[model samples]
Target: MHIITRCEEMKIWSLRKNKTPMLHYFLFAYWFILLVWQNLGAGGSANRGGMDVVIKCGLLVMLMIYYFMHATGIRRDILLMCMLLVGVYAIVKIEGGLDLSKILYYFFPFLFVLLIFGVGWKFELNKRQLVHLCNMLIVVVSYIAVYALIFCTDQFANAFSIDNAYGNELKSFLMSSHEYGMYLVFGIMAIILCMEFDPEGTKNRRFWYFLALILFSVNLILTFSRTSILSLAVLLIFYVLIFAKKRLRNWFLILAGIAVLMVLVIPSLRNFFWEIVMKENNDAGRDALIDFGMAFYRDGSVSQKLFGWDYAPIKAYLASSRGLGSFHNAYVQQIVANGLLGVFIMIMYSVVTLYDIFRTIKTKKEGSHLSKFFISFAASAVVFMTFNTAALFASAIDSYFMTLFTVVVPKYVNQSIRAGTFDVPIKNRETRPNVRRVYR
Candidate 1:
């Protein structure tokens, strides 16, 4: 009787310990669902006036609660700097007499950035928990893939159909094909990281990851996004080069060579590649846009040049000139809207983040799982940001992935330092190798 009572007590204790994380997992699922639904036009089409506001407000509350529950001391400086920038921008916009509602709309995305970092700071995951998170992501992507496959069969079948210009692209109920591509790429990258880091797992884990890779890869290709495809390809190459064992790297090189040879030798493959990747002169107008933005900045008055243009002014200018609002390139957009000071701030943020990653790598054990995953994620993010604007100042899903790595990397390093897992010495090291590592 005593033994049975002890076992029962232990079971209850285990359940109590797990309850919070389980709740977190469910909350994350809900958050992800909202992200997808918002991108899917469900919230936009159904509740254009009020539902969207309710959803955003509700999500903001949930994020705040979640952050408080799991918040840690990591990345407080970055958070503060971000908040400072937002405040400055708000002041500038308000001073320029921009619409109050528009100002709030512009500020909303930064809040998501804060929420993401908070989640990352407090994210403590055991191997099982990490696996569970990956599984949740995989399931979401798979559902999107299947939905697109089933409902858009005719679109998929006729790649060049004139019926719909985007018939070949797999939007997957998303607002745009590019958005769908980004989500697929992010999902695929996460699965790849999980598979690489946690290879020796439960039965058939590798198989499942491999299957998911193929599925997401196909879906990504179907999106027909040149930038996303390039980003994914670059990330994959970096992953193998940086993380793979010597023998594995050799095999990867050989496979890459074979793929290139096949593309060159096969006529149909060459034509397909040319049509999909090489035929599009996507950069044709981008240079002109950059030039125009620079001229506009140059011609502005002293105050206008210093602060650049407010959102309303920029929107009006674009409407009158090109009938399109975006500056296309994030760097150019910042220059046009926020001037040199804004550009400087952004550069500082990127430099600090990159420096943090560099410092962590120096202290981390060679081939450490955390280091490899962080590097892979950072590579993807850097590439994505270079060619895309979603992660720059938008509260899109792509931005969340970038924010996740920034927070998670610091948290991992902090934990490792506390545990003395880092290879570098904590104390005087002049007598040792002249190497220093710090997370400032």
Candidate 2:
């Protein structure tokens, strides 16, 4: 009886109500499973009436409901507006409109960030804790990645049998190496924020974070993803060269030395590095796809240019003519999907976010390290989404993850600043003025 009572108490303690529900961790778990399943081409689709669709949507609805319970009028209004805006935009005037899978995969997580972070609801944890929590997620995922590379192999990350690049490609849990690249994007972004927010974190914590960053960087290299690498490079340049603290900058230099040594010592690694730099992945096939897209766009009528034939017809036409569905270029995908309107909306995704981020950064110059991370991210994202990397309208999970950072994350961070609810205590807080208004 005593043992049973103890067990029951433990369970209750774990489930004790917090604004950040532990169940959402399970939601992340499901997302990981989805990545792995999709990697293996075994994942279900909405058309097949897959349980993945039901469970994903159901979990999101539940998360929203839980937040609504504690929400003030403002929170509810924001949540409702998020739902309606995403719903109406994603559905209205599109081919095969109202794809639960698309909305779930592409845009659903955008709103969830608001609930956990601040705009829609506040987790019991402070902003510093929340940011670290996110970084720790990368560390956990990196551990799994190590295990998968060793024990699972081709099941997690695939062996590259491509024409030019010859090595193991890291695409664990997602369909493409490029998508996995964005996973690293999220990891690196979190690390940047954590380091800036808490540069003197415990030695043990710093070690673990450094380890996670190494793993993420190594896999990013192995992925041989050009745009992803370029995006990260820009961020590193901005941070390490321009804004990094002395201690952090030294560590970066040390890593650079190590990378140089590896290139000199390891022939295969050297060749692989050389190949990525030389743009070995470029080919005529990609060019053809771009050509087809431009030609199709050029031939469109005025009405089609304004409203588009939606993405379905483009996919169908591409399949019928070229035997490939995607244009392999994000900008081209926008041109064909919803024509000029699609192109404009897609551009606005980055443009508006960049404007917001810089506007925030401009106001935060006085002893504020918080803006450094956002500046790094905004610059990197613009570069990443510009290539075959995944534009906002590309229907790739990369795009969705990017949106979470570039759009939703910024909004909430701004909200937290204005409300004075974000509790990230900096070592230099005493030197800076109180948080000022983030521009509209």
lDDT of 2 by residue, 136-234 (tens): 557656865686568646533432333354344566645567777777867877776776665666354787778778778777776767777888888
Clashes of each: 0, 1
Candidate 2: what lDDT?
0.59
TM values, all candidates: 0.77, 0.70
> Model 1 — which ten-residue stretch has the worst lDDT?
9-18
Flag regions of model 1 displaced more than 4 Å: 1-31, 40-54, 72-87, 98-101, 105-127, 160-167, 302-306, 316-325, 365-367, 405-440
Local lDDT at 213 for model 2: 81
Candidate 2 residue runs with Cα over 4 Å from true position = 1-52, 66-126, 152-163, 166-168, 199-201, 246-270, 276-284, 317-323, 365-367, 393-396, 424-440
lDDT tens readout by residue for model 1, 46-165: 455555556656666776676555443325554775688687777766765755345445565556545544334333343444556666778787888888889888756765432323
Question: How big is the RMSD of model 2?
Answer: 10.3
lDDT of each: 0.60, 0.59
